[model samples]
Target: MLFTTCIEHLRTQPIWFLLISSLGFFTILKKSATFLNWVFITFIRDPKDLKRYGSWAMVTGSTDGIGKAFAYQLAKKGLNLILVSRNSSKLKSVSKEFQAEFPDTQIKTIAFDFSSDILEGVKEIEEGIKGLEIGILINNVGVSYPSAAYFHEVDEQVWMDIVRVNLEGTTWVSRAVLPGMLQRKRGAIVNIGSGAAIVVPSHPLYTTYAATKSYIDQLSRCLHVEYKHCGIDVQCQVPLYVATKMASDIASIKRSSLFVPSPDDYAEAAIRHIGYEARCTPYWSHWVQWCFAGLLPEAILDSWRLSIGINRRQGKLLIP
Candidate 1:
């Protein structure tokens, strides 16, 4: 009887120990996912934090380029879309394209040109939205520098137009949508900014345009800090010469530093980066240049910028 008992104990010992070890391993693994999630994850840092949307998303300048890319990507992720554009026909075309691709999602178009003297139409857009949930708001539609010329030489109206569309439109849309987001305690704002916002080069066409982007950076930063505790995320998407109609002039589109990202790639990186990052420097080289700009003396920076090749031909911006 004693020998039989010893054999039984020996056989059960190994199996019992193995079972206990397996349970312990699984318990630790589960806790790790929970622990990491609880500690450092900020502003939808993981897939589990993703809040699904029921109602709407508004992207300004949605008919083309970065805005268009954001629309398609958001639609693919199952969000209902609102496409805004100055052209009804272009808006319709964009709406139709999305409708065909995402039969399951809702696509609406607002045909108001926010860039031209037609900003009087912004009020209509302000009243047009009704959302059960405004999950993602992308302030993307904006104008570019007209020509690489001096600041004073560029038409004053054009500069005003840039400020109106790029900065004011963003302000109005963000101000209009905040009530919904704050009430629900969930939403994301993606503001499209430029490298010029951080490193203002001396390009004639870029002067006023850079100022507009700087305003966007400041506004976005304030919103990010204000809403972070409330679970709302504000992000700025800055791309260095992303390939789109925006960069159609290939002759002058040299990458001063790194590889130029396609609009799609730029959108993907920007969309994935939610929350506070000083600015979304898409390329390492762009980031390096930006740091250099930050370190430069203001007078020196301005001097070098005006001296750069973009203005060497016709602009007497040298302020001699």
Candidate 2:
């Protein structure tokens, strides 16, 4: 009876019914297309072989976290590595580990801290990669607050260090490596970005960190346009809550879950996303989070993020 009444109502308001039906149909179609595209990119698309961009890959902040994971993954693909990190001892240890595991793959270490002199670090990288064809550059060196705090509550030097390491570091390193890639006429540059910038509306307490990552997103998009015709791919891979030392120490995410993947698992997905989009959230679960986050109102997101930031400031466990 309800169905027949609804059909009669629709017939009575034919134009209104048709317009509503059309709108509903198109919305479903658009959503379906989006879902299919995500599926294809996440699962079906074959990743480009890393060697085709160049025989060597350089990863910044490679002593630990996602950068280290990328180093191992690239080495597994038989590419020589130029690992850049701040700690000489840790760099040497990681270098030796890589060499032992992948005896056939060459490994080099450059111990230049991005938090220090930017130009000197760039010079070090330039000198290290002098003769090698560095086909891939991973601008993954970044720093975040130890814990969330209001903008004024954070120490001056702390924020300065974050800007220096996140923004200046990425800019100088990309500048140092671009000449070689431009000369070769083929390369890939993947900048690791955070979901704090792209996924939510406003990250209140971690303002500087999110702002820097937003800058990375813009930089990657512009570079992608500028270099696509030159056969270079520039991408910003925005990932959410990977279970690394950084996440554990900073965000209090102690355990890896469906949404929070281990560094290796995140990097495995991240590697497959290069040379495709200008920006992407590569992990499937992260993508799902991104999708749902997109559906909420900006005001609601802002409020939610602020509450989380407050919790972090209070030393509450984010994922216990």
Candidate 3:
């Protein structure tokens, strides 16, 4: 009765009623769209038909972990691959493996260490990929601290390597590939990011790694807006954890699960989301974790992160 009376009263002021109803409808519609977007991302499964972007895909750190996984996934999509990594032999071996499996697809390898002069290495990449219709670039190469430590206790060399490999590598490699993509006027660039990049808790011990990934996140966002008009897509695929050598020091993620996925599993899901979302935690389980984490207060999350980092540091030190 009271609600009915209120509606009747508001109707007398027709403009006010119209404005309130419009605002309510808009808010409901906005929420519905957001819910539908998550549903679409979670349930839909499809292989990336990457030929629309270009004929070939390039992956840095292609010999192992997520980079190798991306290479395999792209090859499965019927695109030729340019494999870039530090080990010449490993690159050759991976190239041979892909050639055997995807017999119809062409494979090329470039040995470029991210820890070296990045510009020089990019020139090598440029030379290696010359005259090729390279359409996709996966900036997957990065380095992390050997173990978690206070910022002052970290070796200076370790800090330099992390910044050089994570920040400089992603920036330079993207630069090397963008010209070809622009000329083609269609391409996709996926830069691997970390959950530590302000997506979850504020990482306390591994400050450098988190900060570098933060750089990647911003770079991906800026590049997306800048190049979307040119038929290119740039995205940062932020993942939490995977059963890979890079994450071996973390005890909780030592084994792969639905949430903490294997590299191959994560890559399969990550590739599907590349051209669609600007910043995404590609695995469905990770999306659930992201949402759950969002509900906790920041103070609690900060303390939890600090404890985990300390435990991980002790565990790493105990290993002889």
Per-model clash counts, in order, read 2, 0, 0
Tens digits of per-residue lDDT for model 1, 74-111: 88777888888888899888888899989998887888
Where model 2 places Cα greater than 4 Å from the true spot, the runs are 1-13
Per-candidate TM-scores read 0.73, 0.96, 0.89
Better of 1 and 3 by lDDT: 3
Estimate, for each residue in 255-314, the C-alpha lDDT of model 2 and write its tens digit. Answer: 789999999999999999989999999999999999999999999999999999999899
Q: How far is candidate 3 from the true structure (C-alpha RMSD, Å)?
A: 3.9
Report how far off residue 143 is in candidate 2 (Å).
0.3
- Name the 10 consecutive residues with the lowest summed lDDT in model 2: 248-257
The most accurate candidate by lDDT is 2
Q: Model 1, stretches more than 4 Å misplaced?
A: 1-55, 116-119, 200-205, 249-251, 254-258, 276-278, 282-304, 309-320
Clashing residue pairs, candidate 3? none
Model 3 clash tally, residue pairs: 0
User: Model 3, 1-320: lDDT tens per residue?
Assistant: 99999888877887977898889999999979976888887676564568999899999999999999999999999999999999999998999998999999999889988998888998898899999998899999998888889899899999999999999999988998898889889999999999987566689889999999999999999999999999999999988888888877544456686667899999988878878778888888887788789889999999998887897888743222
